[model samples]
Target: MASNTFERFDLESSQEWKPYIARFRQYMISQKCDQTLYTAHLITAVSNRVYKLMCTLCHPNKPENTEFEALVEIVANHFGPKGSVVAARYEFRKREQRLDENITGFIHQLQLLAQRCEFDDKLEENLRDQLAAGVASDAIRQSLFMEKNLNFTRAKEIALNMEAAANTCKIGKENTIDNKAKINTSSTKSARRSSSRCWRCGRIHDEEPDDCPYLQFKCNICTEKGHLAKMCPQSASKLTPYNTRKREGYVKKRYHTRFSNYFGSDSDSGSEQSEVQVIVRKKNKKRQLRYVKK
Candidate 1:
């Protein structure tokens, strides 16, 4: 038995040890083995860890329930004295590949380890399951957002808050996301407020009159209309005191005299002619009076 064991080991020793060790390490890491093998010596020691997982998956007896440790034991049982680390790695990869596919199916099975774990409410539980299955947070949140009243942004906020709480019960510390959202809301409100246009000037402002220039008639003066006070034809023709004196109907009053004070300094040359006629009428009246007395 000792001769056979030595011969079997010698065969493995003939293979390039460093490359074999490197290849085996890659296999283990890719397979997601818990314990790492640093050297070829350690590979032989830790080789059983891989075979143990395979045994647990393949075996039916005593397979009531198996944790990571039970799987490790099964992997160790397979890495027996007859197999070399290099040969064992190839076989390990084959088994792990099948297990990887089954892992996806098993997660959805709802029978293996579902009831053992405590679940959050439906929302959180579904999110957790999706993340475990490598689904993105944004994708899940977007899907939830399609539901009634579940906006994407709001759902993301809830998820981020929940994660922050789970990490370290520190509420409101991760509120930077909320602060940006507030800035957006304020910006929208400002945009809405700025939409009002002024009544008099068609310019954007905080408020507009009910009778804005665009809606109501324009001022006649500014728009050159018939009835604006500044542009009224009646006002243009209305005379001032100076213009009234220049008109034909104006009769100038003497300083402190009546019509008998005909030779007034205020009269022009034509006014003097009217005074002479008045004197002639008085003379004619005197003649008539004298004849009556005779």
Candidate 2:
């Protein structure tokens, strides 16, 4: 097996010493370094401050030499998870997944925080609860809560599946609504096109009615076919007074007959007679007609 080079350790930045030492230990294990040379190798890899401290404690002139196990314990006591437990717990409790954040990223964050907590057997259960609490979606939370045997691995799987399903459903609904809007817009355009009337001939057509053959034959004033009355020079003169009076009498007689039928009255003598005067007012002129009903 190839040996891995150990990175030098720093003592001034005590916060990073724990992981640094852990990695150094792993490298030592892989290299199968002997216990007798463990302290010597560790002393060689550390910064000046740590190197001087180790030299003072394990010098040959000293009364006592520090053991490798005791050195490890001293480093751990000074820089290990003990000092970070409260901060880790605070962060874990405050951790919450954002709606836009992926569930994988949120779960990974929870895992890192759980490591610092050092919950022992309760680690898995605490991780599960944190995972459930941090999820942005209520549906996923409900699904996780419904599980009787929830664990970190199972919770991750279920939460991922639920988040995916929710996204799919949201996309489907948006697509459906978009399709409906498009259909409605297309139908409105079709209806408007179908109901369109040509300005020239005043008739509905697929194309403009200006080119129609009947357009030239139709009259504007009388609305008749075959000729335009306005263009015709031989127009009829106005009616005479005698003909006008005769036309008025005919209209008056027609109105009386229609009203009598509507009232269902036949015996002229027994029924009471009432006069309904209709006044036709136009501009500044007024014309009145008296209808006698029995």
Candidate 3:
């Protein structure tokens, strides 16, 4: 591994001490750094403020005489695990990702917490369950649950692939919706342009001919083409016919009055005189018709 990987191991807070020391020890072993130089490497890897503070409190004697195990114990006592293993396990169980947290970062955090819990044969199973539980996507969780013989490595790979596919699908759907919106906007503009053209004269205007007085040529009264309501022939015909129906009603009323005069003009006799009035009115109507013709 690169030397820069150890940079993040610099302990800044008490919570980081456990994982930091564990990773540092692994790095030292892999690099085959001499056990005599462990203290020097530890001091170099930590932050300047922590190293200075440790030097003042821990190195009261000569720095070369300080035992490695004593220094490790002192650091562990101040910043290592404070509670029992059971409490650590409980915290690991409750570990979850926030809504805005990244999935891979959350899994890595769970793995770090699991190390402190000291899970053995059940470590991969526990990590898998926690990984699935803390994932923000339900699709990945369900996919993990459906697997028969899933281990941590395979589960992680599947989850990553599923997350990537979901992001791609979301982007595609958004692009499709944007394209549809553009198409609908263009279609609406075309419809508005078409509606502004007059159907009768084939001329374009700001409004349709039915609503625009300058563009409209049909008569409103007669509903005919090529004329306005002011010059409509049906307008004069409508005025002339208005009193015709009223005059007809007046003539019928006069005829009924003549029948009533000849019939005895009594309310009780109306039913008995109706038949005679009908016969006499019909004969008088025919004679009046002949006199009018002459």
- Residue pairs of candidate 2 with colliding backbone atoms: none
lDDT score, candidate 1, position 205: 55
Q: Of the candidates numbered 1 and 2, which has the greater lDDT value?
A: 2
Tens digit of per-residue lDDT, candidate 2, span 251-279: 22122222334345453645554445444
Number of the top candidate by lDDT? 2
Measured by TM-score, how close is model 2 to the native structure? 0.61
- Residue-wise lDDT of candidate 1 within 263-292, one digit each (tens)? 456555443233111111232333111111
How far does residue 242 in candidate 2 sit from its true spot (Å)? 30
| Per-residue lDDT value at 146 in model 3 | 94
Number of clashing residue pairs, candidate 2: 0
| Tens-place lDDT digits, model 3, residues 1-294 | 225346544455544666677777888888887888877777767777777667665766633357766776676777653668898899998998777776788888998898778789999989988888778788888999899898999999998898788889999999999999999998888788766755544556555556555434666877877546665666545332111122432332111211243334444453432221111133345322211100
For candidate 1, what is the lDDT?
0.40
Ordered list by TM-score, greatest first: 2, 3, 1
Error of 3 at 166 (Å): 0.8
Q: Which stretches of candidate 3 lie over 4 Å from their true place?
A: 1-71, 78-81, 120-122, 198-294
**Pick by TM-score: which candidate is best?**
2
Q: How close is each model in CA RMSD to the real structure?
A: 24.0, 12.1, 13.8
Question: What's the lDDT for all of these models?
Answer: 0.40, 0.69, 0.67
